[model samples]
Target chain A: MALTQEHIQQRLTEKFGDLVSNFETPYGMLSFEAPKDQNLKVLQFLYDEADLNFQFMTDLTAVNYPDKPGRELAVVYHLHNLRDNVRIRFTVYSDINSPDVFTASKLFSAANWMERETYDFFGVNFVGHENLKRILNVDEMDYFPLRKEYPLEERTRIDKDDQMFGRG
Target chain B: MTEHHQHHIKLPEGSIEKQTTTLNVGPTHPATHGVFQNIMELDGEQIVSTEQTVGYIHRAFEKLAERRPLYQITTLTDRLNYCSSPLNNMGWHLTCEKLLGVQTPKRVDYLRIIIMELSRISDHLICNSIMGVDTGAYTGFMYIMQYRELIYEIYEEICGSRLTTNIGRIGGFERNFTNTAFTKLEKFLKEYPAALRELENLFTRNRIFMERTIGTGPISAERALNYGFTGPNLRAAGVDYDVRVHSPYSSYEDFDFKVPVGKTGDSYDRFLVRNEEMWQSLSILNQAYKKVQEFKGAEAEVFHADVPEYYLPKKEDVYTKMESLIWHFKIVMGEVDMPKGEVYHSIEAGNGELGFYLVSDGGRTPFRLHFRRPSFIYYQAYPELVIGGMLSDAIVVMSSLNLIAGELDA
Candidate 1:
């Protein structure tokens, strides 16, 4: 029997029923969201389970959603099972006031820098990471640039003419 | 009195501790081949620990993409991995096409394959030759660079620029390939094999090169996976996973090729794997060219897709026709609305699986766009690979990994 999205979803729901929600297959990929605290549990189960061994951490990133009151930051994990050639996306939401998610660096060594990058840009703190500092940005930067609060352009720059830039 | 003092001061063997010296490789060094720093702590000549700092060339591309139109984002991808700019361009276009639900013609897919393979060859050529240069063998570097120049000429004939070739559009190519481009490609196919043979003869079995590279920076297959290794680096670690093979896109399934794998996952294995892949790319290029030639008349003339609102009109049409002029204005201004959905599309870039994860809220610009750079992923393991190794071996390991600073800090 081939590994399909339904099989993986069923296994996940059976283990942690109702804990994993918002299960949707967008463009044929299985994506779901879980609580921020249970991130390591879900990752461990996916890795240790015989049929669903998603050992390869394809990517780890964070998306900021300021409109959502409680869940302002969403840390997404893309995992791939090489044996079955299947992929699943898992996300965990964190509050803006205290954005802390458990570190997956112990499980996947690749998560070390990725978590730091997420912290650098989106300010999503990965608790228990050995070196949880900015990876790509200058350490002197006081604010997270990727957060929705900041504007894309430099606020201090006044030399540019708005009429020439089509803003007029 | 002096003899008594000396006898009294007799110390135990190994009492003195070895002092570790801290050395900075570069924010600008010749061996690093890019602007990045590696703070290495060394005990004598052996590396004890290493800390890396990137972001010297950080341009905030993702932030910029949030403001720019979809078509304008193609220019940003050019600077990501300049060695394989066309691959990035095609990957971005494929992502946009997926979001728009557009299907490109067969001829366009074949043309894309030819250009992409040529870019892949150029990328691997630079890496392998630079590996030779780092090993103190400059002849192979000089000999192989000429082929890279030829590939650039092919790019020039296809697109206007050579290095940063923004070669394609959303649905397909901006223009059809000219006859001169075909002639140049044919010449390249005929002459490159012999040049490659000579270049390989110089480095492949050379005892000095082998001794310098083999077992110098060996990463186990399991650890390589844990560190998110992909492309030639992961293949060198004995993993037979290629994005082109695993998830076929852009008509990759139509062609036949082999995914070269290596054992030991050392610098030597990486070099050999890249060399083998260049051969496979050449084979794929030949097959794609023949398949493209099979299309005749109207089929060959069709470069862009049938989607008028997305693809820009030709300059002549835009100048003469009112409807074309309006469509051109709308497309350039990003007034054309697309479906509201999120999509993650990846392509087999020269370095690895270069992916674009896009979130759309049915707006002119993307809600969020993220580039999954393989260089950024693989470079995190540098500290682990270099620890407990000789200082010189660190350089070999860095080169074999082919860490493009642009992609790393983007």
Candidate 2:
């Protein structure tokens, strides 16, 4: 049987029951958020559940929502159940201050580099990541460049200018 | 340090020991091809382990996308997978269309399929021929390179750029496919199969080539899935999951083509899978072209969908008409505001699933855009792939993975 959105929603609601909330079908994709602490449990359930085998990790990345205070960083995981050709969006929010989330590397090895990249840009600290220094930016880069506070380099800006950083 | 970049060792602390010799595959070496490289720890000829480092040419495209308007970001997507840039271009456009809830005409989708398949052929040709070169067969590389140029000529005819073609707009093609482009497509369809078959004979049947690649760098289907493998790499492992088939983007469902699979996912399996995919792409291209030729009268003349608000105006139209001038100016200057939506769209890029995840806040620019680059994802398994293999086999497997640095770093 093909996996439908309601089936996925029911499976999640039954398994975790309100632990996952904001169940929405954004652009025909089942999207919901799990508690930051229970991310792995949710992932494990979604994986181990024979009918809900979303084993394939399509993408892993974080979005910096500057307006949201406690939930500043939204770490989004796009998972695919290849058996049923069904896709769902699983997200967990973390505070920019703490930004600690459980790493999915243990479950999905693909999450290793992606988590590093997410750390490199958004400063979303994976609490147990094996090596979480930097992936794309220089190691000495003190600030996460993708955060909304550090706007993209512009000629009009006077504070922290390019010449000050030796980029000029 | 010339000692395999001690600065770039990404391995865990205790994994590397003192006995094995460390060899640099490349950040610039000719054999590695792209800017990314791996530091292999070899016990004589056998690779004990590898630590790979990437992002030497990091352009911060995702960060840059935060400020640019929707249409302006096409140029950024163009730089992702330069080998099959039109695929990236089309992928971005489709993402934008999905977010905007714009339905593209069937004719537009067919035209896009034609361009996309041509790009797939070009990309797979370069990769397969490069694999041949790595296996010490240089003649096959040179033999099929001209056919790749023919594919490029087709791209040139349509988009006026050989590489990094920002081919189509959000709605559809900037203009209709010209007669020259169609002529070039016909020429490619006529000549490429024979060349491809001979290229196959040169590598597939040769005993040396078979021996070198047959069991080298094999991965099981389970491990590949765990490591987020897709495209020909995953299919080479015998899982026939293709984005085109599974998701059916841009009217891919309208046509019928087989998704080729291979057992014992190795360099040879990857090579065979890519070669077969090229044949299937050719068949799709033929069907799309024929479907395009079937459009008649008013339907034939239509190119871009009737989304003037998003589609860029023709140069002549912008020059002549005042309304066209305003819309063009508005689009170019980032005055148009996109609807608030989150959309993830991926296409079957030549390498694998090249996905674009866009989140909009009903602003002039995207709040966030992430490229689910297949090169970045699948290339993570390189260390696992090269472990316990001969040092020489690492080079062939790397080329077989077809990691384009532009996409990898992005």
True contacts kept of each: 0.80, 0.83
Candidate 1 per-residue lDDT, tens place, A1-168, comes to 679998999999999999999999887789999999999999999999989999999999998888999999999999999888998889999999899999999999999999999999999989999999998889999999988789876779878754554433
For candidate 2 chain A, the 10 contiguous residues with the lowest summed lDDT are A159-168
In DockQ terms, which candidate is top? 1
Query: How far out, in Å, is residue B17 in model 1?
Result: 4.9
Model 1 chain B scores worst on lDDT over the 10 consecutive residues at B1-10
Query: Model 2 over residues B1-410: C-alpha lDDT tens digits?
Result: 45663566488888967688889988998888889878888999999989889989999999899888887799998898899889999999999999998999999999999989988998999999999999898998898989889988988887889898888898999778889889988999999999999999899889999998999889999999999999999999999999999999999999999999999999999999999999999999999999999999999988989998898988998899999999998888677888987899999999888998999998888999999999899988998888998988889999999989999898
* CAPRI grade of model 2: medium
Q: Give lDDT tens digits, candidate 1, residues B1-410.
A: 55554346778999998698999999999999998899999999999999999999999998888767798899999999988999999999999998999999989999999999999999999999999999999999998888899999989988889988988888888888999999999999999999999989999999999988999788889999999999999999999999999988999999999999999999999999999999999999999999999888888797878999799888899999999999998888788776887788899999999999888878778878999999999999998888999998899899999999989988
- Report the lDDT of model 2 for residue B166: 80
TM-score: model 2, chain A: 0.91
What lDDT score is found at residue B322 in candidate 2? 98
